[model samples]
Target: MAIIRDRDLIKDWNDIPIDLIKSCIQEHQKSIPRLDLLENYYMGKHAILSRSMGSDTGLPNNKLIANHAKYITDIAVGYVAGDPVKYDGKQVDEILEVYKQGDIVSHDAELAKDLSIFGVGRELYFTTSNDSPIPKATAIDPRQIFLVVDDTVEYKSLFGVHYYPKRDLSNAVIGYSVNVYTEKYVIKYNVKDLNGQGYDVADRIPHYFDGVPVVEFWNNEEQQGDFEQQISLIDAYNLLMSDRLNDKEQLVDAILMLKGGISIGDDEEEAGRTIRMLKKYKVLELPADGDASWLIKNLNEADVEVLRNAIREDIHQFAMVPNLTDENFAANASGVAMKYKLLGLEQLAKNKERYFVQGLRERLKLFANVLRVKGRAVDVSDVTITMTRNLPANDLETAQMISTLSGSVSTETLITQLSFVDDPAKEMERLNAEKDVDMKRQQKAFGMPINQDVTVDAE
Candidate 1:
């Protein structure tokens, strides 16, 4: 046997071909001898011993001898026939040493033969526990490594899995060593120290690395006032004037008598000037003024009500006579009609009732002419016809007759008759008396009224 160095043994373990290791174990039945023995020998011991041990004095010598032979054969095959190897502490140390040196460890035949006894591996790599006194080297790729030095900080091992930390790379400063996994880096100074040193820590921080300042800069040297004082004074004056005009009482007074143009007096000229001012500002306007009407029209209902209440109050207190005349009435009606026209009422016009009645009468006359042309007598008794045609009949019978014939009567005659009877009861009494006297005269002349009952002798 040759004495193999630890490094050489590790190299062989790293260099062995995986296929050769498998073939050697299969042919010799030598690899994993202990595992094979465990599988074959003890597996059937219980069944064999159970029957033999039931004898009077326990198992016979022959049966015991046979069991012993089987156990011996298994042990010899496992230990001698199998080319087994032991991977003790020394071998493991050697492998780790090689890893620490950053050298490539390849599998070879010798190490594979040794490991085949236990059926382990052809090649393996090792590392020291993190707390062990092992000199660590930089990973082959530095980008894969994370270096942290803070005592208070903590880290978790992901069981050899790699993870990259998110970072604002654009904001990173030059000459800083960043932990690629943790996204943290050591700073030359803390925030307080940076401020004490008059160095803007914002300049070094990842969030504020860009050189642009956050606050805007103004150049005082080139700036001018540009008459801002005068502008401010004017603004103050306008604000005060607005406040004064906002007073409800002042606004109403300014709208009313402040512009007295219809009176005569030395003060009239001043009043006229005031009126001009009010008109210019549109605080007051002439009657039927388009602009004034527009203002009122645009006002909300509440505001209109407020102004109307104010006007009513003024009229009540001052006892001013409202100038209501035919001209004014006509103007008001025209305004109302104009509003109605705008609201889509096409028939809205001056003297609306007259226009409506005339139109109705024309329709009735056309209906009556149509009935007459069709040879129907004008039955004036139908109230339905009288109402529909706007025909007036003296009585219900006449109204019914008018409806039967679909005829119309003159409205003038009906209206005159309706007015003739000042007292209805007196008119009814006089008419009944006249009717009785006429009936008597007819009875005396013809010996009876038409269709009156009479008796005669047949013989």
Candidate 2:
């Protein structure tokens, strides 16, 4: 199934065929399971299964991989979009107060985390309550929403389809929508509510809207997770890792290697009893000319360790995530040194920042429309979205540098670079407060009146 190249619909999304939308949504359904698997891996819900040979012996140990794929995703996204976007649009500040009122920061972080795992994230804008001052933006799981695009001209996504399940008065309704340019066409049908227990038909037709209220985000144009390709490497590592553990277990509870003719039992029950007795007593009685020797083989621990490390390193390399466990990240590593170690991650973070900032701008544009309808049109185009990495930083070293570069850069530069300062304006206020307190203390120490006002330069 493919999206028909409707060049005519480029400017008018409403001209797109309804059948095309339905076909795309249906075709995309098959990919949902694959997305779910990736999500499950990120959630640490591995599918390793242990097998049991017979009921007592030869146990098949299936251990999950280190799940570093999820680890890589968390660290990358945490360092990239971990911090909230610092709003620089003076006019959009009041417009975004509604977001703070809705706790959009936490929600946006979660969405970014998911985007790291799936390479796709989205936010649906709508009013949550009657008194909602700002429209609420909801983070949507990619699996729940399939983006229909003309594979060739999806760069702008001027026309597309999306389907998701929503709860209605009686049951979960499968809803589909086609977004053209800025308008949205929606249709919904009732289905079993996941559990297949209840059913309700939400009577809704193909409703039309003036705009697509959702803003889609992607890690990049390719929309593939960092560790997605290394999944096979992860599996290889898990297999080898599990083998080493299994070897140790077997050595502790080794198999019985019997030799020569030894008849100690006449029936199955007797045979079982004799086998247990041999193991318990660690002894075996045989004929006068019979002989036996215990058999045990050592596992190649060094070989397994080497293979495990190699696979782990490859996973880290492919994911562009630093192995924090690496001994190279020793004690007292400077912020610059850590950044060097995580150079690839920092670059990835930069790319993510660029892509995410575009989505944020679009969201602002959509919100701007809402605000305009309310007679408060805020041009968020001037707003600069700053993505600060939540990486480890040595505040002392950073302060020293700031002091060294005093007057060279703006004071705002020093405040913004400080890892602890999420908002420069607020940090400035806090610094002033601390400085005032220190000045009062110093005045008392000098036997001066506490009421004396002295400008204490904290520089």
Candidate 3:
């Protein structure tokens, strides 16, 4: 539980007993592999295809089931980190430019998606070069790494170990080892770094802070996902949809039957004949009297619809992701009314916003440290984040509402709420420039030179 200080010798980190490191990994490995499963489910990669019902007999309809897992998570992430979060402070434009150049919005979206997938998402912040336009943040899947916090406090992570593979020059895999991260140091440790005679401090790279460079985005404080509670529902939903499709096929085609004495080759030949007849011809020839009467089935469309609706309702209910395409929400509604409809989503967004803010602050802190090392030190302590929901609302009405707030609201706040402006700070700059041009034109019209500054009291 001791704090890893900059003055701490490299031996303190490297001299850890082999048994202790093994125990740390042993305790957490069991829980790490499930992350891959959850991520696959989110991507609709395996759950639909892998889980098979015993009665997949005739047709090979391998159509994937309704993948609501991806929808719910995508909507949740779209709301959580939808817009680009800005850093507000003097000389922070350089940092903002860096984020813009790096496409931080897409990077954050990937982070949120992984957060939903693995319950824990991580980003590695590092500078590519001294003259790098912006520091890079690489999103790492939780399967390749584990997040470790102090066993006592449970929230303070002093460091993290990333187990990435070491490949040869020809891109052949050799082995994997842990890369240890702290604020002031990043040390690569292999089996040798752990057991070698003495610590080689020369290999360590110094950084700005004395904490880990990894910023984590947790789906929840307990590190659980939105669909975890109703994860089984996804399987059930897919099974039902697949069964329905299979049933529909059987019901409409009317499985051919030979009631009386009739020869139709073997089962494979019968299947091929049936397929050929269904696709090419509609006529069926019955050899004997009352030989075929069409084995029709009544599958109760109402019951299937009920079951499908129930499963869908349960999924959206438990996931807290409402069906945006619901007919009930088809009407064009006010923002406040729509907000009420999205109350559950709003609640989930609040939780995500809280966690996302914590990670973003850590991100800015790393940026600040890197900038300090470059002699362009910036204070981003007071920088705050605001998340705007990408919801359907009447924009003109909202703009009119903002107009009513004349002196009550700040121009920056108004610009943020305007929806058309992507960056409020930059829009404010544009507005000021336009104002200066207008004043210069007015001064020249009044026989006043445009070179002199205009005073407020001079009017």
Candidate 4:
């Protein structure tokens, strides 16, 4: 969302002007309000909460919130990234060892959630300063950090800016501290002026990664949040539900209408006492021709329920997320039937995977560069990333499919089909090891040495 194209940054390349950096920061500031709104929506702060019930102000104004935004986002994130992404390639174990040390699984999930919430996510990879330095990645708040890309067709990232306001004891913003991440160096700046036009370089530290250490993960090509398109629908649902409750409350406190003739004591205090006595006794003294009834508005329960169901369905449908609690999902659907039920969500996950995998490749490159310096260079190009959708698997069906395709497909591919197998390559190794042990036992039973080949008699 913070992509700005400047020909000058490309022309100068190495010598980036300070004013240009300030302008990019200012450009990023413009998008903060929209980001803040999306974040607030996810946090259950809907427009209905601030709604004004005008005119008849005495009516019950219940601000009920469903928090469907968070629900949909969590569903998408969990469906895509509930399980850790698997890395496969020649010598990928070394890279995975680094991932294990950095706890990439948790960070990956966090990044996916951020993408769902803000439409874009950012991750910063840096090397630890302690002994035995290893590259570590942490998800950065998209609101506080952004990458500056060039005007070329590729839209290559020129640099990254991570800036935050400096606050004093009273939490008053005095100035700003900005960290500009270039390919070679991380330049720190302190802007003391009210306007961000002027700043002084506080420090410059060299980061020996192959590229700028920040990676941007987009939710989609347009970079819109999962529920962004259906936000209005969500708000409408919240309003309808809240007002429905209010209507029920109004029914409970319906006004009493007395027709014909009714009498009370002459004084106003006596009238109040008579009303209290009527409430306490559940009886009203009236003339012979008097009649009483409650003034309640007719409520069509079926219509309200239908409208509520429509809104709920649209929010899930347009968002491409499924209502997991819906009857379609609860009917014990398995395998292909369950996949059909989740087709929309799977499509959404596919787009997310496309971009998420891109960001991960960039992260892998950064780790590869750092590991290269440590005499453990890896060929990142050979590495393939596998994303498994987090879903309930039908183990019997999967086993049958695997058995049918055993010889037709590669063992690694079959192993990957099994949800229980975390690492297909590792599982293959264990399988081979077991086969070797079985072969050795057969040779010993035939009175042959372990290394010697055993020839079985046809007789």
Candidate 5:
């Protein structure tokens, strides 16, 4: 949850209330356990691994873990951010150049993954030095940074808190170093004690950006991770599969029962010798009316398989992430059919795009403000952010659609719709240049005027 405060409580950053900051820190501290749990799940440290089998009962209890959380998260992340998010508009090239310098594509991918894993992502935009005024942005761990907004209808972001543990020479965390980002400055504070009960100002550094540099991106309206709701289903699947394997192992090591055939001495050593001899000879001589049979638990393999399939299907279905290995996503499927199969994922992506776009717009605004301070004219309002789903497409089908709408739609529009085209404006410019070259060549060949169409008599 985001930290909220009254806007009028503090006149300025200099008069910031220390108690409120401490409270915010405390509130953030409360969320650490949950965030750590989600991170552990993503890293394959599931709750099942911590379970211990009972030593008293002689049964095979296997703690098998399937990292379905990671699988769902990675699929959602790749589907949304496998292709670099595109930014376009008037004077956006300069902003894009800044992004390129900062390697924003990789940063965006990282942020996307964070959103999938934690349901929230954060980014910080800043300028390095006066000599190099180009703005750079980086993805920040959501657990380390939080935006505090005004407690109003608009909920405008007042500032952001980025805190980390302060370490000495021995690498022991003595306290926390907190950086509070405001509209005009980054106010630094140091909490000397382990708990953030009290703090002292370290320094106040001015920043050129006109607003808070940090931006928060939500995965969905509820800010829930892709696999969060399906975690129970995943756990159930893991348990079922683990027990299935345990049953198989038990079957392989089934107990051999000899009703009345075998006779052994009362001593343990004598019984062991008799058992070894029987095993070595691979035969058992029984008395009359005696029988030998293996005592094994009868497992309903068909029922177990059905339950396994059901749980697996529920995990994927509830996660809203398609099982790529499913036969429904076969290579031979038509593009329309593929899209139908991905409709759930498409809906999920749309919700993600809604929030991710907001974050990108905020990032662009920061860049524009910073560039303006550096004496550059940049209008970031008109910028457009485009997100493409990373799914296989039928080029031939797309080509046919483009051909049919060649004259009806703008060439630039059609060009941008093609998956291969990265820059539609540049592509249009190249097309125009090629047309001019072809026109000049025809004029030289037939000795006709440049603007006139050449005519020839047919024999």
Candidate 6:
């Protein structure tokens, strides 16, 4: 394998022979496996570095030097000679070509800069010489694109710390290694103690070293899990609270509906049972008036009495009356009457006794209507209406008769008596005279129009 550095190589590359290009592609493919292996090693090393030692601290100079020396030995043994099965010159060349063309070596430079920022050299053993330009190679394409290879790379603390020796002459013992200590130092920090501290330790540590914090490496898997659990608990609590509030609202609505006169129970016992059921479901509470009040307020006694009378009438008709031909009469009279009787017989039925006040109220409404028709004043108070029964039967009968006669009285005689003369002038004169007489009477009653004599006519 040869390194192509000729100026004409760029132009010739465009027209490279098909066979050579094919050879290049095949060679590139073969080299792909080794390159992949190298990448994996590089990535593994980076991961170790990131997880253990801070990248901003200067590298352990001794460890780095030892690692580099080992790495070089491995490359030579693994690719150049030691084992033919493990080494292939053509594959190695292809890998190098890929790195050269892609200019991926710049990535190494970036890694070195980051490592210097991490304070990695504080404890590591390695050497850096200003005389030696970092052992680096470049392949330029004249097209402004170039590949760089950095071989003799050394880490430096961006924070100006030279904790580790420039070169480790002393043989230090590191992880069961003695002769020159050939391994990278991977630091492990305890993150458990930092939970709930608010401030990010990783972020703070970098600032102490005058470096930007790379929080991406902070371990937060456990914290994330705890956060999710807390959210779930809060959601559950909210759902339960909402359900309780909704139930209370429903109970209030039911109470209002009952007060508004919607009957939902048959009797005191039934109403009590219904209330109990609501309470059992945590939807209602027993009011101060108790269950009896709920029953009396909601049931209409007059309607129940009407239904009872209708039923009795139907039962009598069914038992005594002959064949009933009308379907409407049969259905409404018989069926409805039977239903009323059955309900009346039932101890738990809604009846007049359950809603006595409601019955009285309804009767008063009818009496008011009758009074209106008879041109009589309606007794607005409950006291007047309730005292109706206390009046003698004869007196009540007479009053009813008088009311009926008053309603039937003809208005024709009254209209005739009230009629006026046909002539408008005569009617106006009569009206004026009547008005004058009325005014004089009013003045006399009040001791004269005192201001009239004081008025003087205009000259």
Model number with the top TM-score: 4
Enumerate residue pairs that collide in model 3. 183-209, 183-210, 183-211
Q: Which lDDT tens digits does candidate 2 get at residues 1-459?
A: 123444544565645444554555556676677778788777766655443345665565758568887889888878887778788767977666867887878987888887788878867666544663556777866665544444464444444444455556888565333332234544333444332423243433332223566567878767877778888887777777776777777777765555577676899999999989977998888777776654666788788778888888898987888888888765556666766787888888888888888888877777777777677768877898877778667788889999998899978778887887777977888888999899889888988778756567799
Candidate 1, which segments miss by more than 4 Å at Cα? 1-306, 309-350, 377-459
Task: Evaluate all candidate structures by whole-model CA lDDT and list the values in order.
Answer: 0.29, 0.69, 0.72, 0.87, 0.85, 0.29
Candidate maximizing lDDT? 4
Per-prediction TM-score, please? 0.14, 0.79, 0.80, 0.95, 0.94, 0.13
Q: How accurate is candidate 4 locally (lDDT)?
A: 0.87
What lDDT does model 2 reach? 0.69
Superior candidate under lDDT, 4 versus 5: 4
How many residue pairs clash in model 2? 0
Query: Which TM-score value belongs to model 1?
Result: 0.14
The candidate, 3 or 6, that scores higher on TM-score is 3
Residue-wise C-alpha lDDT for candidate 3, range 177-286, written one tens digit per residue: 66667656777655433333332333467655546677777778778876776679988888888877877787776766776565555689786887687568866666
Q: How good is model 2 by TM-score?
A: 0.79
Give the per-residue lDDT digits (tens) of candidate 5, residues 287-397.
Answer: 888788889999999999999899998888888898898875677576677778889999999999998998888888888898898788899878888999997766788
In Å, residue 120's CA in model 4 sits off its true spot by: 0.4
For candidate 4, the per-residue lDDT at 266 reads 82
lDDT by residue for model 4 over 1-459, one digit each (tens)? 757677564565555678777777778888999899999999999999898778677878899999999999999999999999988788777889989998999999999999999999998888888988888998989889999887788777788988888999999998889888988888888988625567788999988896888889999999999988888999999999998999999999998888886666689999899889988998776788898889998999999999999999999889989888887676965466777888899999999999999989988888888888889978889888989899878888889999999899999889888889988878999999999999888878877788866567999
Pick by lDDT: 2 or 3, better one: 3
Clash totals for all candidate models: 26, 0, 3, 0, 0, 24
lDDT of 4 at 385: 90
